[model samples]
Target: MRGDTSPADGDKLGREAPIPRQLQQVQDDDLDPDSVKRHEEDDDDDDDADEGRDEEVAGLVPRLSDEEERSARRARNEGGAKLGRATTTYREGDDDYDDEDHLNHVEDGGGSRSPFADRREQRARRRKPAGVLATIWAIAREALPTLAISVLSLVFSGELLIHLARWPVFVKVDKLFILVPILLNLKGNLEGNLSLRMSTSANIGELDIRRTRETLIFGNLALLQVQALIVSLFAGILASVLGVIGGLGGASEGPKTAQRRGFGALLTKRRVIHHHPAPSDPSMRLRNSYFEFVLVIATGMLAASMSSAILGSFMCALVVVTRQLGGNPDNIASPLAGSLGDLLTLTILGLLGSFLVRFEGTILATLILLALAAACACCFFLAYRNAYVRELLSSGWIPLVVAMFISSGAGLVLDAFVQRYEGFALLVPVATGLPGACSAIFVSRISTALHSGKGVSSSLSHSSSSTLISALRDILKLGPTEGWIVPATLFTIGAGIEVLFLVLVWVTGQMSFGWPFAITFVITSGLIVAASLYISHLITLFLWSRDYDPDIYCLPYVTSLIDVIGQILLVVAFATATVLGDQITAAVNDHQKP
Candidate 1:
């Protein structure tokens, strides 16, 4: 009705739209122009009449050309306003409706939106969850090459034994075959324990190698020295006893030849020689045994002490450096150190043997022994004075010592069978070193898991598969790849080393066997890696579930088992090669006859 214009008033009515009742009441109050404007503003601010005003503006507006109307609507929509308005108005209590009003903002490219919000949304969309398979692939991607190189380094340790085999002292002392593996394995086991200890300490914030934590460093070093001395001395004594038992009631001709001549020949030769009593004095036998004893003990002490000092310091530094670099020392320290320990210990033992053998029963031997014993005593005293050393001794030292003895028995077994194969002696260091290297890797992983509280419960039952699964999950969480990748890679490295070593041995004329022997060596090396990995996993799981520190217990046990298993496998391989190799060689020789 207000917009209806009479025919006579059409021009006048066209000049203005009808005022609403609210503004008309303000106009009737006789307000000044500015006051009237203020009153009109008050009417426009009314929230309840917003819809009516919008409808009035839409309905009462003059008609536009079709193109103009479309353009106006497009502008209104694009600007996120009401259909006829140029600006948006958010109601006082309707902020939630703002998204609806701005729906076209996205269609307009959203350039007016906050960049950080858009970026956050984009990131959210991009960050999909990494499933189990993806995780395994990622972990294996990082670990495979590192493990391969580490294993390859260990495989080369076989060269040390090759050199040792050519040493005059090693040749003269038949019992060293029984002692070398034990001592080498002992060095790895001991250093591996030190690595684990240092890794755990670093993880727990106890490790500080900057001389301010000298007590902890000295305490650990002392414990390592004492453990090394005790274990190596015990290993030396145990190996000597086994050698005596195996060597007794036999001919003076080397055990290798005596075994080939048949036991009856050996015993008859012993009896005949006894009845006809060679002029050699019994004291000569005692003197020889004593000389072997001095050599084993002296070399053992030197190897243990020197390896502990050098490798212990190195592993500790490695762990510290890795941690500072935001990497897991657990992944790198043990494997690297284990391989290095094998090479260094064997080289050092060979050198010590060369020097000590020259002084066997001389006053120089006594002086060396006294000096070594005094140094060992000083280390033991320092270790005894440290509370941490006392704790390690009470809980950790005995198992390690026992493991050394058990590993010495494995050496005994190797000595018995490996003698039959002429150049199979070269396999000893590689076999023992490879397993220890693998065990060190796995033990470090498990120890890190334990220290980080990532898997297994403190009170979990030892037989629980959940504990094993948890432990495995901790490792497997590194990727979708199975745990066997490490062992398989190790096996590959070992096989390659076997092939290379065989070629070297053949080229050097140290061995006469052909591809059959090489194949057997490679196969045995693979089996050793696989067995070592499995045994290490089981040992770590057992120690972890039992609430014992796997670091202290795992290395020795795994390495000891590896020694035994590796020796057994090497013997089996050699026996297989011996039987089939002879036939293969004969066939080839027959074929070659022109």
Candidate 2:
């Protein structure tokens, strides 16, 4: 395919029909441009030829309109030229009129609507329902299994966090707890961005071809490694700073060993309690000092490095397989990324931190940190050299920071209500995850639409005021275009999944749910889903309007916003349920007793 170099070769490759002369020039510039330039000068030559022909055949000449004369001359001078640019054309060898008829149909300086476009519009009208149904079916097949797995994974992540918080390494090295929310938040952003980008490429057919697939996949992985390294280091540094602040607070209160706190306590701005034990060895004096800080940073980098390598590869493979299987990765990828990021990161963190702590006083820890730094520096250069990811490296940092800060608010809600509600931790994942995934699907579809060269995507892009209400009014116009189907289907699936998860928990006796809880959940989830979709749409348009790529910035902002909204909503739902849920449960029990 690469060896093929002619205009006809593009047709063989199954590119969109009617290759534009612009692309023709790109493929065969020297030959096609020279010919096209000469062809543009044909009117003068035709005039001269007409003058000579008139003199030679004056006796045989018949009166004709100027339009008819031009048509006749075109037919005579060029056998392959159309007899009438508007109605008729000639075909010779590979040179067919199909391209001109379908794509380049012209009435004057501007092209009129082609008959092909009309036929396409009619066919689309006929097949619209079937198309949407088929896509929804495919989405269900891909999404359901992955979502089940992801939801289960998040459940385990929540449980794991509870255990991990109490684990010796985390209890002793309290900064690690503070690192959880920050690093996981940043990692999700990195991976979600990767998944969305890959899904976009798949939708546009970039991943269908082997060469492009390899380039994109490799570039994305490199870019991911660069991002992971940076975020992990940042997490470690932030944790250390917080650790120092807590140490100072604890010192002023009493002569206590520096005590570490959970992500909820630290990020929520609660009073930090540090209770450090006396170091047994001279080398162990580093416990509350820079040595512990460097050690935490080192462990985070290792854990993050490993997690990104594992998760990034999985996401790439999942996207490729989904695309190959005629499924939509956009529906499944982000959800899994969010669901799995915390579990995997913490698993790596707890194990790696404990292992590294054993050698903390030795030179191995310092070497490991230095080595990770060098490796990350090398990855940065590698990603920089990649054309696809170069622009991305410079642009996405702001969203990660913003998302992290926004997530801290969620941490505050979590800390306050976590002790107040039964099984509150279990509900957190579904509350936040389902709504975020629903909106992520919308963002993925819209990003794909915005990146196209022409067609419906072009129709969707326009200048609008940067306001959520303006964006909402603009997006509301998409209903007539079948654009609403994507969000509708995604939300429908999400709600169904949310209900199923509730049933499963009820059956398993993991959490008791009454009529009031059900009503509150349905309302809260629905409200969050609606808000997530509109806000994500607003963010995407706002970024795109300012020349930011939605694929990079949208998901992080959307997920962070959803988490905040979801947490607040969860707290409200639980508060309401605590009142009504108890009464309903008591009434049901009394009826059974009677």
Candidate 3:
């Protein structure tokens, strides 16, 4: 060896300790190519660490050499942003999700309280109800219209009206008889209009407070009104001709005298009889969809017109007043102006109501109602299945239905109690109908919120199943927070709205009380509720069929169906009541005479 230790000798001295058995084995093995690659990766990590250290040194303050300050500032900003987002989400339920969109607030406040505890008991109570006799109920409802119509027609026959006019009550209130037809038509037409608009909205997300949308809704009803006017005029003429014919002794009643009397002369003498189509179409085949809609609207208007004007007025007022309450404030008007369009619609519906009720009789009117209901249901189903409509309807209906079922008997009972002592049932419409309308509005808001990607991105991820499980656990422990709170609020608001409307209707009823009116209103309300439930369920099924995919369309079909049915039921219900009242009156009179 040279004077300095040779390289081999130094290496031997420095590498005196042999590598451990595990390390030796790793180094020796060629089985795992990754072991050798990992060793190479360690060297790259060392190089990166050196570069990172240089960057840190360069960024250091000249004198203070402080890095912590910049880090702290970043932390504070992020924390502040997160807190603001959380706060904003809890309060303003609108679509304001972006961190930058938030209003800056102070430091984190106190812990929040749960908003959904009120429904815990309710949820527990909703475990699948026992099987109801739905078919029996449905059949009973089906037969009700014919029974009611025949009875009502018989009561309003020229002979009965004459007999009734002899009574003191009838002598003073004879003018009120015209109201029966007016109201019957109003209820059917308005409900049909509502269903059409809602269905269109649900189908395309296009049904807004916009002038165009409102016009579409209003225009259709206006046409129906025109149809009603023509129908009534025709009916009046026919009745007059018949009256003149019957007035003459057999063949002596000829065309010349009928013409001289004019249609008006005979109309005043004979009881007017109107004929309406049945619920199930005679053809029962799918024809031109649009044509059917037009027919249904016309029929519904015609049918509802047969009810008393007082009832029609109540129905129209409820619709006109509450329509805005059912709309989504966020919806962009579809080239149509806003509330003005709704006003125009109300005006149209009102005009149609006036005409329909003026001449149509109860028996003929009920058919129009059933036809409308069927038409609406079909439309709703179509729209719900349509990809576009499902998106629109989804935003509102789910919450509305839930709220209705929850508060049903409870709110109605309360309303009954309120009206019992002082005969204040007239307030029922305001109390019940208003809240129901409001609920519709709020539920709409909630659906729009979810669509907005505000609180949480609405899209379910690929791993959503796992995430859902995690979320459920979190919910069980912590209660409903941001996302869930939206639904809860919507549900409550809907319930409140419905309750208000019921109260309003009740209050309005107290102002006038004829046995016919009473019987008709009760029957009409029950029918209305039943039809609403049926249509609502159909809509729900349509919506869920899309697998809760908000992107799908389904609401329009259900809403249309409900709207049509609701209108039809309103007319039928009123007609039934009228018939029941007449029969009772006749029975009482016969008993007194005996």
Candidate 4:
């Protein structure tokens, strides 16, 4: 087959696969661009636009055979390049940068247009500004429904937290508040990262073969199990550390505070304000208990491991199905993974924790924790044995740890202002999650484009200087012509969702904010999502240029950053509503007079 090398050739090359016939032909002066287009056309007959992009990149960007595709992923420090005809040169000096022409840069090519070139003469003409508009409209038409469903699902997670907060498991369990949000944040990152990576793997033809598909899917699933366990353990430790701080006199608040949201507290006869439910026996300091510490770890590990297993498999299958159904998984997978991860992880933590709390000091709890450790170790061994995910065992830890620290800092912001306004906690998901969902989608698309080997064969594919150039264009350039179409469409949808969230809260009487605060909420959330989309673009470029896997690097930090930013924006929206919302202030005053 001209598509991939034979099994014997793959063995002879060790880990690297051979270049395709069209790519090798690029070295010959007799190479015909039209012929290359024909081969690709037969391979992807349904996609008319990608034909041009394939022809364009074949003459420009060079790809490696690698140790990981046939074995595509190589070691982090290893630069295993086998250029066919074109050459790439990265310049640090500003002089080499084409300030005027974003797409033309350091390339020794066989007369191929860079995948990222904003060359209006060739591409922009066919896609008139109207075509660009239509392009984004098509993207929006498919994507908005998925984004909406994902965002709506977060309400269940938020509601779960609200309902589960008052459970005795939370009271008896030390720092469950501190533990749950961190686990959810970390787990969300893991699942979203899995979705993004799977989408990239699938689009690049990595999963086209049954053998390769099995390796990638199973290896990644094993890898997820390991990551989830480690991250869960980290969550338990952070909660303990924060609980220690609370004991020594700093306040620790988390998703549990969401339970006390709304102004109903203002009208209630008794003033009952506490970070978590007070124990019936005031003498017991739950935070200091040895058993509580072990249970916290147990609960987090159990919940995170189970959630990752469920969400990771679901993400893999979903991406595969989306690809099979002739849809881009990039449009749907990542956001849904994030939303479902949070909801599933939280629910498991709450319900399982309640059951486990009954066995806290017993041998049963200890046995369960040990068994989980053994199970995670088994998954780690499975991950290490697989060529596709072997390296992941060592990679991606720093980002996860860093994200935890960030989300932990966000706890301070949440603790300070969560009780200050009505429906603040209820709205946290839609506010923060909408932007995060947008960023995950953006990051996944950039990652797929950046690593798809075929250059920007589709809107989902990028290369070095060209990659950065296109990232800027794709994220920033707008209007009827060029890059603005997809981004603007996503932002438009995000803005609509943001406004809808506020309306839902207000109409349901869960919150009372006047025009001023409603306006503030819309403006603030809009900016946050805009910033999130742009930041995802930047982070993906940064990681990619460094030769690090952007799939692992991009999604985690963006989601965590959104957590902090979303909560701060919520507080700002609330502060605005409390001060400038005459309707709210009047209601509070009226209620107080009675």
Candidate 5:
């Protein structure tokens, strides 16, 4: 009835078998509900002839005229566009999609509907913090053995003083009490820088120990040795000047005079004692001044050279081992360098001073000075040739020298106080070494963080209160463990070392302040270490905020500050220990009387 052709065309199409009524019914049922309803209404309007025509058209794959075919293709394309729009809407309203629909969509090769949501989920999983106990255990496992070795090394540093006690030069030169600590602090500063440079270089793959001469490692090593020589020369001259002025005040008395005059007289005597016994001798004073100068200078040179050689070598090995173990050398190298520098510098100074004092005016003394000068000259020439060495010298050396001078002043304070408190003298190395080591370690860690481009953000350059808060927050984030755990661990280690140091003193028959004094010393040393670490952290953050390199600016000042603070705290601890011990003794006496 709706055919374009006549009855012949209809009959020709009808020659093909028609679809069964059941299949036709299934096909009609599969149509959209609106389409099926419209078709049923259309059937009611057409009656039987039209109904038969609709059944035939539905049963067969209806042929389309050219215009109809074009329209059909356009409709199909429109339906495809609508399907794409529906998929986008479904993804945006992901909660509206059933889990089965989501599964079918994925199974059909559609990617994750919400990629951003998936990424957020992944980030949430990644950002979880480790448990507190686990973090503590990890840091302890990492730090304890190294810290133990550091403490042992610091304790051994007392051997330097013990050996110096055997040296005539130590007694002959009045300024050595001031000079020794200065030189030890200087050596620590230089070597600590070397360790930092090496650790940083190694971290970034710049350090190649096997080919050190061609690498930055060689330049840093050269810089360290040259700086050591230069600083040694400066320290020697400064100490010599102090010695001369000290001689003017009758302070350069020999050990024999000190022993004979009693501790009070020895400390109060302001004139240089001439080797000559007679008091009416002007020549005696001039000769004694020259003796003090030569003694201080020679001892300074020897100490510096020995420390550079031994500590430099030790630092190289330390860097290599730390790198091989995949541990951060910054955390351990500074303390190791500091403790070893103290032990070796003091011990070497004593040994060389003992020998040098024996030949003070002899040709051997002249030969030693000439040799030291020659060695220093050779090292300087080599350092001058290196570009990195030159840069380090220009940028870094002056601050270090200034810091050493300040440390020398701290040493002077210790020397002045040593005569008043006998136990104080014995505790000086422990007081100075432990806190210095702790601060040095922290400085190294902060320096490494700054270098590695972590922790400190560049936005902190504003120096505003908000920026300061941000900078502090960055520091906390950098080493959250450092704030509490590190300080506590350092305090525990320091207390143990203090106990060991006092025991060593008592065992060696050096000085016996007894158990109450020991308890005071332990508590004080722990407090000093905690305070020093906190100060170090503050200094590091301040320097880092200002875009200053903490490695060069921080270690020297911190170590020097620790020396001053350690000495004051030591004195306080001694006073507290004495009062507490006296009270305990009085209580015991009163109880016994009852």
Candidate 6:
């Protein structure tokens, strides 16, 4: 019956398009208590029929046309007379659509309504469910840009040109093939850790803090870093022994030695899967601080030993500096603190990484990386067993963070061994494979296990899904809210596209060549950083407009994309630029002959 009405004059759609405020006028007004008391005493069959009619009236939209107005009034009258009431007391008034009036109501200039009240009501309307199919469809549609970016990156990275130019270099470096994958894994791991921490923080009330939480997170990172270094040290020793044995066997020692050296050199790397301990509650939050610190110390020692005996002391000093500096309360502030701190931290870390890359070997690097990884695993398991930590950090961030840290640590260790023994530069590719595959596998398994009827109650799982679906259905049934998801969704898509392009450049062999590689790297890096900022800005903006859950769901996916691209870039960079001399020589020779 409500659907039969046509749009009224001065109304955009139907009746006067009530600007939300007018719809709640009844609730705001005082009710006649004596009239309500008398209606509660009625018990006639006619009263029951009138009650049904009154229920129907309640279903009608509060904003009405003259037609709806008469119908509701008639319904109320019939319902009331059956209860022996004199008449139903009601009033109908038209709200003039005035910008000034709306502004005043919203600004507190008019005490009639608080600005937040109408906005809250609108949000409640928006959050109602649209349905399962709609929700799934929306999610899938939203992911299209992400999928497109992946495809594009795979296609257009311009790597063929670089590969063709640097064949000999590829030949020379082919033995250390594990390097690319290792780097990508590290990047993803680190980013994933950050996301996990963010998500976990969001779940608790600690997402925004000035000091305590930041110190803990920084300490954890340092610990993880140190543990990685320690692991690399052990790996390097093993690699050296194998290299020495192979050299003595009289094989092409050039390749063997190179493999060992390269393996050791690639120690100071960015891992794809990094873990960030989320501060869920005070206890686990506090515990992670100490745990992460321990991990960093262990990793640092391992990596230093493995990578370079020459710079071992320097590397240790760097770790100590990082640990001490990172622990400073001022160094690690709330996420919103000055970019100066982050810039400083980045500079210090980058310097250390550069130093390590210049002198470190793959075998040593891998050992330290693995050692740190083991520490991360131990920390996670220990905390998981404890109820307090589990409760605190057990949100969307933990799974991804844990998966990334452990996988990255494992990848680095394996990469070191691979480089030392195999002379295959598998870094970029392996980074894409190991952490991506393993994390996805782990997530899938966990989701399945949790959803399966054997362990958990089937009814509970079903109920939860059903509730979500129902909520979505209700949301869809309500008209759309102010178009906030539009811009947010667009930003997500744009970032995802940029990510794919970055990956493409890395994969297409642009990363290996001299100038082209450099250009590609800059472009890719800028896009990633920009995209992240844009997403954060848009999400925050949308949240102000409507209640949108900024969860870790997108973080892993984004980090994975970044990791893949970063590793691909590193591999291409090394592979393409190695033959720069040859290219220049050939060009010069041709020019001279002409």
**TM per candidate:** 0.58, 0.72, 0.27, 0.70, 0.64, 0.29
**Candidate 4's error at 376, in angstroms?**
1.6
Off by over 4 Å in 4: 1-130, 248-250, 253-287, 453-482, 576-581, 585-594
lDDT of 2 by residue, 324-351 (tens): 6656677778778877888899999999
Give the lDDT of residue 182 in candidate 5. 61
Residue 472 in model 3: lDDT: 39
How does each model score on lDDT?
A: 0.60, 0.69, 0.33, 0.67, 0.60, 0.33
How accurate locally is residue 572 in candidate 5, as Cα lDDT from 0 to 100?
A: 84
**For model 4, how does the per-residue alpha-carbon lDDT over 118-226 read when each residue is reduced to its tens digit?**
2422343464345775678667866798888888789887768767867888755548876877788788878887888898877654554344566688889989989
Q: What does each candidate score in C-alpha RMSD?
A: 24.0, 13.7, 23.0, 12.5, 23.7, 20.9
For lDDT, the strongest prediction is 2
**Local error of candidate 4 at 570, Å?**
3.8
Candidate 2 C-alpha RMSD relative to the actual structure: 13.7
Roughly what TM-score does model 4 have, to 2 decimal places?
A: 0.70
* Number of colliding residue pairs in model 6: 101
lDDT of 1 by residue, 1-594 (tens): 322435556456454443454456556776577767755554453432344344323332122342343334334324432331212111111112124333223222222332333443455557776666664454454444555566566656765665576677765665666677667666667787888877766654344223213556677888888777877887787667766765675433444435544864676688797796555533345434666687777777777789788988887777766666545566667777677777778778888888877766656655666787788789878776654455576667666667767876775786576545555555566666655665676667666655544444233333344555675555433321124454455455545555666566567655566666668877787778777777776667666655567777778788777878888888887788777844222222233244
Q: Which tens-of-lDDT digit does each residue in 1-594 have in candidate 3?
A: 112335566488564332332345456776467875654454344444345434434432111111232222233233321111122111122122222212111111111111221133245356454233442343233223322332223223323433433443222222223222232222323333243334323322223223223334443343333333433333333333433345454342323333544764555455335333334532223222332223334432443333212232333333333333442231211111111222233334334434543333333444655665565455455444333223343343343333323333333343334322222223332222322232222223333333322222222221234454554343234311133333333333333333344344345442333566555545455444444433333333223223343212223233334334444444453445545653212222233242
* RMSD in Å for model 5: 23.7
Lowest lDDT sum, 10 consecutive residues, model 2, at 88-97
Runs of candidate 2 exceeding 4 Å displacement: 1-35, 38-132, 250-284, 453-456, 459-482, 581-594
- List residue ranges in candidate 1 displaced over 4 A: 1-157, 171-178, 208-213, 239-248, 251-286, 289-296, 405-432, 458-530, 567-594
